[model samples]
Target: MAYTLGIDIGTYETKGILVDHAGAVVAQAARGHQMLVPRPGWAEHRPEEDWWGDFVFVCQTLLRESGVDPRAIKAVGCSAIGPCMLPVDVMGAPLMNGVLYGVDGRAEAEVRDLTDRIGEDVLIARCGNALTSQSVGPKILWLKRQRPELYAQTAHVLTSTSFLVQRLTGEVVIDHYTAANFAPLYDVQTQGWVDDLAEDILPLERLPRLMWSNEIAGEITGRAAAATGLAPGTPVTAGTIDAAAEALSVGVDRPGDMMMMYGSTIFIILRAAERVADRRIWYAPWLFEGEHGSMAGLATSGTLTRWFRDQLARDLDPAEAFRQLATEAAASPPGANGLLLLPYFSGERTPLHDVHAKGAFFGLNLTQTRGDMYRALIEGIAYGTRHVMETFADLGQRPARLRAVGGGTNNRLWLQATSDITGIDQEVCDKTTGASYGDAFLAALAIGAVRRADIAAWNPAAETVAATPDPVYEKGYALFRRLYQQTRDIAVELP
Candidate 1:
């Protein structure tokens, strides 16, 4: 019997899964890691502490629990957070901790400088994106400007995937979907370096080779094999971001199907053949080869809820607190008695794309209870999601249904709230956050044991929940939309 392994180095955790050829997850193990914030806005992960150590632990745990022979595994695949910049030396040692996604605002000066160098309109015309903090080009430029000496010694710049691939296969490679985020550094049209863009910052000679996710990067080295309990010389695929792989696992095969990943941040990945560029919405690659793919997202989703539950309601036990809060939230009819939450604790991304936007509690009343507040918090995020969805339709791509994945979908209230706000049905996966399941499926196809057409047969049985918008609630949501739109300026102005 053949088996495949899938691993994800997530923002807050490292997870590894062992699956047979049939898409059945035979064994799974996970370990949580810390997210270091040295300053107010900077987020960093020590490569040795978070990436390597946690991955070794996950591999050992999964192998021990599964009781399967390591020799039987055919291929290994990985998914990780996207577009993070990691500088590696010739021996492939990390020079510094990776700079995280656009949400991490430490590179504001670099963003401003680059925007001035390459006009925003010309950038949009060439690469289909204005330089947001999300792109690696700005972060690379930041390192060059701030630490010129370190930048000079840098041999190659790699993302989370490329760093891991270098360790496992001794190859420096990147997947196109993630590499495209390094805009202007890479020419999306020509699929190579953009010498004309950001030339002052750094030489673009060493960008990792861009390959499709299914392409084989290289076999695991003997050293990498011993570190994890895998057989030597195992082939590893050039995989993708956790959200993109999660979408594949939930069966986002066609353009109409949207993936709503309720992870550390909210990611909406919609597949489209045409380039859809809106300054408010992030328009980038979405894991398609030789075709245009787009995604839009918010900076916070599950993390904000976690912060609220942790800092605000620490005294209550998790189940007891969530049960109490969810029940209270469910009791309040839609609109939450005129209370609304901005959910911009970490600033807003997607449709709004304003880094200065601060979270707010709008229309709060002295009569409102904690229940109303909790409901508003959840609804605020749902509203943020709705804004992105509305943008997709505005650009001529509309998702008929959202396949809910990640730990957030497990909450019935959150799932139902997603349906209620969108006025569309949601298919909550039997196993929410099933990237491994998706990886297993892809691995099986990569080995030719399964056909691409048979994915529907392997899809986990999902409970379809439909939302019928109430006239009263619809009227209230209209006000919710108006509040954000009308007072966006005020929200951005807050300290």
Candidate 2:
């Protein structure tokens, strides 16, 4: 009657699950949080409020609602939307709000400074990534150069999951997957920190110890036990970046398996044998050993849909609004009747590393309705995926198949559009996201309840929907490919 818990903190919400050896989410809970936007192109989250507070709720709620024995919980694994930079004091108190993932663009200047200081080739060769807002190093440089007082007082810099682990186990350590984004700061080739990358960056002592994501870092302390309502000594592993963990949750265990997560920001991760270093695509070691992967990113996927809903659907409930939009969008023919959109509302990433890239609509005839615009947005995101998918293929790293997960797949029409545009057969995982399932699965593996040697024995949720591309989509996707360059001029013309 033992159990495991997988808790995940996302950009806008937190979700957790309590499950036994068989992988059924016996009890689940979630809490929503507001993303703070103080200025244009900046996103922040109160680490105490959004990151750990929601976790407190999920932990307590799942424990109570499941009626599971607190002591019987073999382990707790956590995952978070990350590469978040929040410098903390010695007591694990946040010095300021966390830089909210890649969505926040406050560190553009720092990015340039890093690329100039370290040079792109050294960064790419060493950390397997180049400077983008996604890198933790630039954020650190921002704090150091901009807010010297905070940087000087800073006791440690941590990502989201490691922050939680510090609060839980009274330990400060980051996983390699999360630390990989600390490019130019972490010497991945040497498997250690590179203290000499930048003279103006945060002090080297601030970085946390790095470990593989699955290695048990420490046991939850008594203080964390009281807050989370769990046995104090329960083992907690060094978790991973939310996307990598989500990739794991969707059965991207072995090499060549790809997980395309359709969530707030669409993330594509594919496993490979050796590091296929590409500046266009991020490369990182997978959670467990003998696995490495490359990542493709889209800044706004579900964010675009959410934006449309907030601005256009003031009269509709969330469910009804998405349902109506999906229905109408589905009714529109492929390519939304010759419409194309570049979904770079927050700026494009992956395949094109432009931070100033803007978004626009092409072939938007006056005859097109709001519904057509909505479907055009959907198609734009699908085209974005195809752009990166083609890059992977060009590198001879194309995945054999794709497993789709997260909230975007909840809308069958969106998933269908994505599958059609990419021409990849999509398998929709049941409603589970992030590292939660992978947390449970990893816990299962740890205790020998489920053997990792045979993945078939560790079954994930049954596929609820399957999408296959139609041949008619071929010419449409080909046309969609040209829209990025064709519309780039129009997008910049707006402002």
Candidate 3:
């Protein structure tokens, strides 16, 4: 029987899955790694260890555990957290640690400089995006300015998935979806690199060749075959960012369908009927051709929950800390006992796009317990998600459905709170294996083993988290907005 392989490099871990032609998950494996935060606004990942190394382990382990012949895998697909900025040499060796996504705000000056030089209106008209922390163009310019010596040696700029694809297939290519995050460097109308904007940062030649997500980038090379257990010449698709793949895994196709990914960050993607030209949110060509996508994200979400576990709940065993926190949080009444957190620990993205935004707890009282604080953190993230949803409504592009995916979906309180706060029902699918599962499905589609619509059958909506109205939460959501607005100036003054 034919099979496929899917791997995803995430912020904190890498996961891989093997699936048969019918979409049954045959086996899975994962590797954990650290995400480095060298400075307050900087985040980096060791591409060699965290990305490529993890990928090799996942590939070999998945093959061994499943007892499936590597040759039986018809195609391979991969997705990762992006669009990261990694400079690599001509041989595709990473020059330095990969600069991560919106959470890394090291390019603040570059963002302003590019926006001023190119003119924001022109950029929006040509590329359908504004210069922000998420834009790869600014990150590239930051490298040239801050580390000129290293930039001089750089041959190509790549995101996480592109780096993996090159490692696997000896091809340097990026999907249109991730390319859209490159901002002024990629032209939405032409669906190609904007030479003028890109040349200013790096020569157009340094950019990866663009392709659709489902297109075959190249066959696995002999070198990749040796490192990975897979046979040489295995077909590989031009995989996309993790959120896109996660969306696909849950059948988030067709206009108005949306995916609310609760992972390291809170990422929301809405399938738009047409390009919704809004500066508050990002617009990208969808994974497939003839489709459009609008996206928004918070810089931190599950990461905050993890932080709470590590710092505050460290007395408990690592495995028991999260459970204890969740138990305590459930006991805390809604509104988190009058506590409120901004959920901008790294920075804020979308709508605000304020890299200087600081996380804070308002209305803290001595009487409050750890559970109240934990619940406040979850509520804060839910409020942040609601803010993004309201932004979509403001643009007249509100989604028809909201599908929740990722590890955070396991947190019943968080998912239910998000729905209650956002007033949108969330559909949870049976398989929340996330992007890896989506990668396998995408690979199957590329190899003609599965039709595009078959994802619905492979993973159906298992349950719904309906909005629960609460007057207390209604007041809390209102206060959440005001707190951010009032504290904006204070955040700006924080050194």
TM-score of each: 0.94, 0.94, 0.99
Global fold similarity of model 2 (TM-score): 0.94
Candidate 2 residue lDDT tens string, 1-495: 888888888777888988888776688888998778797667788999898999999999998898888998998888888889999888889999988777777788989977987789988888888888788888888888888898877999998898998999998898887888887787767767787777557667788888877677799899999998989999888887788877877778777889888888899999887888878898877776556789988888988888899998778888589988887787788768777777888877788876667777778788897788898899788888888999999999978767887877778778877777776777655544556777776656655567664333444546634456676567657776676666666655564
In model 3, state the lDDT of residue 113: 82
lDDT of 3 by residue, 382-429 (tens): 999989999999999888888999999989999999999989999999
- Write candidate 1's Cα lDDT for 267-360 as tens digits: 8777666677766665656565655667888887887877777877777898677777788788887788888888877666677656676777
Per-prediction CA RMSD (Å)? 2.1, 2.1, 0.9
Span of 10 residues, lowest total lDDT, candidate 2:
452-461
**Residue ranges of candidate 1 with Cα displaced over 4 Å:** 319-324, 471-495
Ranking by TM-score: 3, 2, 1
The alpha-carbon deviation from the true structure for residue 125 of candidate 1, after best TM-score superposition, in angstroms, is 2.6
Which residue pairs in candidate 1 collide?
Answer: 406-433
Model 3 misplacement above 4 A? none
Q: What does the lDDT read for residue 455 in candidate 1?
A: 65
Q: Runs in model 2 with CA error above 4 Å?
A: 447-449, 460-481, 486-495
**Model 3 per-residue lDDT at 111:** 90
| Top-lDDT structure, candidate number | 3
